[model samples]
Target: MTGPIWLQWFYVLFWIALISLMAIGGYFMFRKFLKALPKADGKSILDWQEYYIKETLHLWTDEHKALLNDLVSPVPELFRDVAKQTIAGKIGELVVKEEAKQLSQDHIIRGYILATPKRDHKFLIKKLKERNIDISPYQELLK
Candidate 1:
Protein backbone atom coordinates (compact mmCIF):
# COMPACT_ATOMS: atom_id res chain seq x y z
CA MET A 1 0.00 0.00 0.00
CA THR A 2 2.99 2.37 0.68
CA GLY A 3 4.81 1.27 -2.48
CA PRO A 4 5.15 4.83 -3.81
CA ILE A 5 3.50 7.57 -1.76
CA TRP A 6 5.52 10.31 -3.56
CA LEU A 7 4.41 9.02 -6.99
CA GLN A 8 0.76 9.01 -5.83
CA TRP A 9 1.05 12.65 -4.66
CA PHE A 10 2.66 13.61 -8.01
CA TYR A 11 -0.24 12.02 -9.94
CA VAL A 12 -2.78 13.93 -7.82
CA LEU A 13 -1.00 17.24 -8.43
CA PHE A 14 -0.81 16.51 -12.18
CA TRP A 15 -4.57 15.81 -12.35
CA ILE A 16 -5.40 19.03 -10.47
CA ALA A 17 -3.17 21.07 -12.80
CA LEU A 18 -4.78 19.48 -15.86
CA ILE A 19 -8.32 20.30 -14.61
CA SER A 20 -7.34 23.90 -13.84
CA LEU A 21 -5.84 24.37 -17.32
CA MET A 22 -8.94 22.91 -18.95
CA ALA A 23 -11.18 25.29 -16.96
CA ILE A 24 -9.05 28.28 -17.94
CA GLY A 25 -9.10 27.24 -21.60
CA GLY A 26 -12.88 26.85 -21.52
CA TYR A 27 -13.28 30.31 -19.97
CA PHE A 28 -11.16 31.93 -22.69
CA MET A 29 -13.07 30.12 -25.42
CA PHE A 30 -16.40 31.34 -23.95
CA ARG A 31 -15.07 34.87 -23.83
CA LYS A 32 -13.98 34.69 -27.45
CA PHE A 33 -17.40 33.33 -28.49
CA LEU A 34 -19.16 36.13 -26.66
CA LYS A 35 -16.93 38.72 -28.30
CA ALA A 36 -17.78 37.38 -31.76
CA LEU A 37 -21.53 37.77 -31.11
CA PRO A 38 -23.28 40.69 -32.81
CA LYS A 39 -23.99 43.74 -30.68
CA ALA A 40 -27.22 45.78 -30.61
CA ASP A 41 -27.31 48.95 -32.73
CA GLY A 42 -25.90 51.87 -30.71
CA LYS A 43 -29.18 53.65 -29.98
CA SER A 44 -29.06 56.46 -27.43
CA ILE A 45 -31.34 56.52 -24.39
CA LEU A 46 -33.52 59.13 -26.07
CA ASP A 47 -33.76 56.99 -29.17
CA TRP A 48 -34.90 54.05 -27.11
CA GLN A 49 -37.43 56.29 -25.39
CA GLU A 50 -38.75 57.44 -28.76
CA TYR A 51 -38.93 53.94 -30.15
CA TYR A 52 -40.85 52.64 -27.14
CA ILE A 53 -43.26 55.56 -27.16
CA LYS A 54 -43.92 55.21 -30.87
CA GLU A 55 -44.45 51.50 -30.62
CA THR A 56 -46.81 51.76 -27.68
CA LEU A 57 -48.87 54.74 -28.83
CA HIS A 58 -51.41 52.46 -30.43
CA LEU A 59 -52.12 50.94 -27.03
CA TRP A 60 -52.74 54.26 -25.33
CA THR A 61 -56.18 55.64 -24.53
CA ASP A 62 -57.52 58.56 -26.58
CA GLU A 63 -56.85 60.80 -23.58
CA HIS A 64 -53.23 59.70 -23.54
CA LYS A 65 -52.87 60.49 -27.22
CA ALA A 66 -54.40 63.93 -26.73
CA LEU A 67 -52.16 64.62 -23.75
CA LEU A 68 -49.04 63.57 -25.68
CA ASN A 69 -50.07 65.75 -28.61
CA ASP A 70 -50.60 68.68 -26.25
CA LEU A 71 -47.22 68.11 -24.66
CA VAL A 72 -45.45 68.35 -28.01
CA SER A 73 -47.64 71.08 -29.48
CA PRO A 74 -45.26 73.89 -28.52
CA VAL A 75 -42.24 72.67 -30.51
CA PRO A 76 -40.66 75.25 -32.86
CA GLU A 77 -42.01 75.07 -36.41
CA LEU A 78 -38.77 73.87 -37.98
CA PHE A 79 -38.67 70.71 -35.88
CA ARG A 80 -42.36 69.93 -36.03
CA ASP A 81 -41.73 66.73 -37.97
CA VAL A 82 -39.71 65.31 -35.10
CA ALA A 83 -41.23 62.12 -33.75
CA LYS A 84 -43.95 62.41 -31.12
CA GLN A 85 -41.98 59.97 -28.99
CA THR A 86 -39.02 62.37 -28.89
CA ILE A 87 -41.24 65.10 -27.51
CA ALA A 88 -42.81 62.64 -25.11
CA GLY A 89 -39.36 61.59 -23.93
CA LYS A 90 -38.54 65.20 -23.07
CA ILE A 91 -41.85 65.62 -21.23
CA GLY A 92 -41.15 62.37 -19.37
CA GLU A 93 -37.82 63.75 -18.23
CA LEU A 94 -39.47 66.96 -17.05
CA VAL A 95 -42.21 65.09 -15.23
CA VAL A 96 -39.68 62.92 -13.46
CA LYS A 97 -37.78 66.04 -12.38
CA GLU A 98 -40.92 67.89 -11.29
CA GLU A 99 -42.36 65.05 -9.26
CA ALA A 100 -39.24 63.42 -7.89
CA LYS A 101 -40.85 62.81 -4.50
CA GLN A 102 -43.85 60.90 -5.87
CA LEU A 103 -44.19 57.32 -7.11
CA SER A 104 -43.53 56.82 -10.81
CA GLN A 105 -47.18 56.07 -11.64
CA ASP A 106 -48.41 59.14 -9.82
CA HIS A 107 -45.81 61.40 -11.42
CA ILE A 108 -46.53 60.16 -14.95
CA ILE A 109 -50.30 60.53 -14.56
CA ARG A 110 -50.10 63.85 -12.77
CA GLY A 111 -47.61 65.20 -15.26
CA TYR A 112 -49.79 64.41 -18.25
CA ILE A 113 -52.93 65.65 -16.57
CA LEU A 114 -51.23 68.87 -15.47
CA ALA A 115 -49.89 69.51 -18.94
CA THR A 116 -53.39 69.12 -20.38
CA PRO A 117 -55.06 72.45 -21.19
CA LYS A 118 -57.65 74.03 -18.92
CA ARG A 119 -60.26 73.55 -21.63
CA ASP A 120 -59.63 69.83 -21.44
CA HIS A 121 -59.51 69.66 -17.66
CA LYS A 122 -62.95 68.11 -17.31
CA PHE A 123 -62.20 65.61 -20.09
CA LEU A 124 -58.85 64.71 -18.55
CA ILE A 125 -60.38 64.26 -15.12
CA LYS A 126 -63.17 62.11 -16.53
CA LYS A 127 -60.68 59.95 -18.45
CA LEU A 128 -58.49 59.52 -15.38
CA LYS A 129 -61.48 58.55 -13.28
CA GLU A 130 -62.51 56.04 -15.94
CA ARG A 131 -59.05 54.50 -15.60
CA ASN A 132 -59.57 54.32 -11.82
CA ILE A 133 -56.76 56.81 -11.08
CA ASP A 134 -56.71 58.45 -7.64
CA ILE A 135 -57.30 62.12 -8.55
CA SER A 136 -57.66 63.44 -4.98
CA PRO A 137 -54.24 65.11 -5.04
CA TYR A 138 -54.98 66.75 -8.40
CA GLN A 139 -58.52 67.93 -7.60
CA GLU A 140 -57.50 71.56 -7.35
CA LEU A 141 -55.73 71.45 -10.70
CA LEU A 142 -58.79 69.89 -12.29
CA LYS A 143 -61.03 72.67 -10.97
Candidate 2:
Protein backbone atom coordinates (compact mmCIF):
# COMPACT_ATOMS: atom_id res chain seq x y z
CA MET A 1 0.00 0.00 0.00
CA THR A 2 2.94 2.34 0.70
CA GLY A 3 4.52 1.73 -2.70
CA PRO A 4 4.38 4.59 -5.23
CA ILE A 5 1.72 3.63 -7.80
CA TRP A 6 0.74 5.57 -10.94
CA LEU A 7 -2.82 6.15 -9.70
CA GLN A 8 -1.73 7.39 -6.29
CA TRP A 9 0.83 9.71 -7.84
CA PHE A 10 -1.82 11.03 -10.18
CA TYR A 11 -4.18 11.71 -7.28
CA VAL A 12 -1.49 13.59 -5.37
CA LEU A 13 -0.72 15.72 -8.44
CA PHE A 14 -4.42 16.46 -8.96
CA TRP A 15 -4.86 17.74 -5.40
CA ILE A 16 -1.74 19.88 -5.73
CA ALA A 17 -2.97 21.29 -9.01
CA LEU A 18 -6.36 22.09 -7.54
CA ILE A 19 -4.88 23.94 -4.61
CA SER A 20 -2.57 25.92 -6.90
CA LEU A 21 -5.48 26.97 -9.08
CA MET A 22 -7.54 28.01 -6.07
CA ALA A 23 -4.74 30.16 -4.71
CA ILE A 24 -4.26 31.89 -8.05
CA GLY A 25 -7.98 32.47 -8.36
CA GLY A 26 -8.15 34.04 -4.91
CA TYR A 27 -5.28 36.41 -5.71
CA PHE A 28 -6.95 37.47 -8.94
CA MET A 29 -10.17 38.27 -7.11
CA PHE A 30 -8.36 40.36 -4.53
CA ARG A 31 -6.55 42.25 -7.25
CA LYS A 32 -9.78 43.05 -9.02
CA PHE A 33 -11.32 44.37 -5.81
CA LEU A 34 -8.35 46.64 -5.17
CA LYS A 35 -8.60 48.02 -8.67
CA ALA A 36 -12.32 48.75 -8.39
CA LEU A 37 -12.09 50.14 -4.88
CA PRO A 38 -10.31 53.34 -5.87
CA LYS A 39 -12.24 53.77 -9.11
CA ALA A 40 -15.28 55.45 -7.50
CA ASP A 41 -15.33 59.19 -8.25
CA GLY A 42 -11.75 58.69 -9.45
CA LYS A 43 -10.67 59.06 -5.84
CA SER A 44 -9.98 56.69 -2.99
CA ILE A 45 -13.06 55.48 -1.12
CA LEU A 46 -11.80 57.46 1.83
CA ASP A 47 -12.13 60.66 -0.16
CA TRP A 48 -15.71 59.86 -1.07
CA GLN A 49 -16.99 59.50 2.47
CA GLU A 50 -17.99 63.15 2.50
CA TYR A 51 -20.02 62.57 -0.61
CA TYR A 52 -21.88 59.82 1.19
CA ILE A 53 -22.63 62.19 4.04
CA LYS A 54 -24.13 64.67 1.61
CA GLU A 55 -26.19 62.00 0.01
CA THR A 56 -27.33 60.92 3.42
CA LEU A 57 -28.41 64.45 4.26
CA HIS A 58 -30.35 64.77 1.06
CA LEU A 59 -31.95 61.43 1.63
CA TRP A 60 -32.96 62.46 5.12
CA THR A 61 -34.80 65.58 3.97
CA ASP A 62 -36.41 63.89 1.00
CA GLU A 63 -37.17 60.54 2.54
CA HIS A 64 -38.20 61.19 6.14
CA LYS A 65 -39.78 63.73 8.41
CA ALA A 66 -37.36 65.84 10.49
CA LEU A 67 -37.71 64.96 14.15
CA LEU A 68 -34.64 65.93 16.16
CA ASN A 69 -33.03 69.09 14.97
CA ASP A 70 -30.58 69.00 17.85
CA LEU A 71 -29.17 65.68 16.86
CA VAL A 72 -25.86 66.20 15.15
CA SER A 73 -25.38 64.81 11.70
CA PRO A 74 -22.06 63.78 10.19
CA VAL A 75 -20.11 66.32 8.19
CA PRO A 76 -21.77 66.71 4.85
CA GLU A 77 -18.41 67.56 3.28
CA LEU A 78 -16.00 65.01 4.73
CA PHE A 79 -14.90 61.52 3.84
CA ARG A 80 -16.97 58.72 5.35
CA ASP A 81 -14.23 56.12 5.55
CA VAL A 82 -15.03 55.33 9.16
CA ALA A 83 -18.63 54.54 8.32
CA LYS A 84 -17.42 52.57 5.32
CA GLN A 85 -14.93 50.73 7.48
CA THR A 86 -17.63 49.66 9.88
CA ILE A 87 -19.58 48.65 6.82
CA ALA A 88 -17.08 46.06 5.62
CA GLY A 89 -17.19 44.31 8.99
CA LYS A 90 -14.22 42.45 7.54
CA ILE A 91 -12.08 44.32 10.06
CA GLY A 92 -13.05 45.43 13.53
CA GLU A 93 -14.81 48.79 13.98
CA LEU A 94 -12.00 50.00 16.20
CA VAL A 95 -9.38 49.34 13.58
CA VAL A 96 -11.35 51.02 10.80
CA LYS A 97 -12.26 54.04 12.94
CA GLU A 98 -8.68 54.42 14.06
CA GLU A 99 -7.53 54.37 10.47
CA ALA A 100 -10.18 56.94 9.59
CA LYS A 101 -9.18 59.06 12.56
CA GLN A 102 -5.56 58.94 11.55
CA LEU A 103 -6.55 60.19 8.13
CA SER A 104 -8.72 63.03 9.49
CA GLN A 105 -6.73 64.08 12.55
CA ASP A 106 -6.60 67.72 11.59
CA HIS A 107 -10.15 67.97 10.38
CA ILE A 108 -11.61 67.27 13.83
CA ILE A 109 -14.58 65.42 12.36
CA ARG A 110 -13.50 61.87 11.78
CA GLY A 111 -15.76 58.90 10.98
CA TYR A 112 -18.93 58.12 9.13
CA ILE A 113 -22.58 58.58 10.05
CA LEU A 114 -25.45 57.11 8.14
CA ALA A 115 -29.07 58.24 8.17
CA THR A 116 -30.32 55.60 10.52
CA PRO A 117 -33.50 55.94 12.52
CA LYS A 118 -33.45 58.74 15.06
CA ARG A 119 -33.62 56.20 17.87
CA ASP A 120 -30.39 54.44 16.94
CA HIS A 121 -28.28 57.48 16.18
CA LYS A 122 -27.39 58.16 19.78
CA PHE A 123 -26.23 54.65 20.48
CA LEU A 124 -24.34 54.69 17.23
CA ILE A 125 -22.53 57.90 18.14
CA LYS A 126 -21.75 56.52 21.58
CA LYS A 127 -20.31 53.44 20.00
CA LEU A 128 -18.16 55.58 17.74
CA LYS A 129 -16.88 57.61 20.68
CA GLU A 130 -16.05 54.39 22.48
CA ARG A 131 -13.93 53.61 19.45
CA ASN A 132 -12.24 57.01 20.16
CA ILE A 133 -13.80 58.84 17.24
CA ASP A 134 -15.47 62.24 17.45
CA ILE A 135 -18.48 63.04 15.29
CA SER A 136 -18.75 66.53 16.76
CA PRO A 137 -17.12 68.35 13.90
CA TYR A 138 -19.61 67.01 11.45
CA GLN A 139 -22.47 67.40 13.87
CA GLU A 140 -21.64 71.04 14.48
CA LEU A 141 -21.22 71.62 10.80
CA LEU A 142 -24.55 69.98 10.06
CA LYS A 143 -26.43 72.40 12.24
Q: Per-candidate TM vs. native? A: 0.34, 0.26
lDDT of 1: 0.58
Question: All predictions: root-mean-square deviation over Cα?
Answer: 18.7, 14.8
Candidate 1 lDDT over 1-143, as tens digits, reads 76598998999999999999999999978865664455587665546556545544444556656655554455556654453544455445554456433224454455555544577566556666666877888877567
Which residue pairs come into collision in candidate 1? none
lDDT of 2 at 45: 47
Per-residue alpha-carbon lDDT of model 2 for 1-143, expressed as tens digits?
67669888999999999999999999978865674477645865444544444433322331121112222334232434433333322222323444442222222222223333345556556655765755665575333
Off by over 4 Å in 1: 1-91, 95-103
Q: Model 2: runs farther than 4 Å from truth? A: 1-4, 38-143
List the lowest-lDDT window of 10 residues for candidate 2.
62-71
- In angstroms, the error of model 1 at 95 is 4.4
